[model samples]
Target: MTSTPSLPDPAGAGQPIVLPANGTTVAAEDLQARFVHAADANADMTIDASQVENVGQAMLQLLVAARAHAQAEGLHFAINAPSEAFLARVAACRLGEPLGLEMEKEREQ
Candidate 1:
């Protein structure tokens, strides 16, 4: 049987959640859990996507939802140090605004 994707532990207050290099559908559940944990902490959360090499729509949706949840709960949510691949996929999927990611071209600068 294939092993489930492992997610990193939640960081402490004001820390960033470093996303897995492959942020695809395979890790959707894990990603969701992480986001929930961070959001429920009622503190600022920074999602680091510097290592994301592969991503899918599910992951994008989760990020969007997490961002909204954080907003509703009065928590700060931000995406930091996004990888080129990650930005490209966000742009391709038109999730930049929802995911709070800068456009690929803009982020490349």
Candidate 2:
């Protein structure tokens, strides 16, 4: 339903940050807000995309914005495994390059 879902504490660790449900335009703003909130709170943040059900440009934007926001906040940012179903779209979006290799490496861990 929403890309960002609802506000929750990243708290550095405890739960895998998830981008649940289908990503849509309406969810982008919330996603950005959550990312900023995360950056503000966590010294480092891990985004788990293993539960990402669907994705779109909005989703891409969310990740990109989150990366930038987290970086600006001086927080380490990483993404868990992204679903294979949307990997192609993620690549095509041309935002993956900016997402860094962290997601891949994290997936391996």
Question: In terms of TM-score, which candidate is strongest?
Answer: 1
lDDT of 2 by residue, 8-107 (tens): 6653355656776677777666666666676667646687777666776877777887778777777777777877645655655555667764234333
TM-score of every candidate: 0.78, 0.69
Once fitted onto the true fold, the runs of candidate 2 whose alpha carbons sit more than 4 angstroms away are 1-8, 11-14, 102-109
Runs off by more than 4 Å, candidate 1: 1-10, 104-109
Pairs with steric clashes in candidate 1: none
| Model 1 C-alpha lDDT per residue in residues 77-106, reported as the tens digit of each score | 899988889988887777887877657564
Model 2 is weakest, by summed lDDT over 10 consecutive residues, at 100-109
Candidate 2: RMSD to truth: 7.7
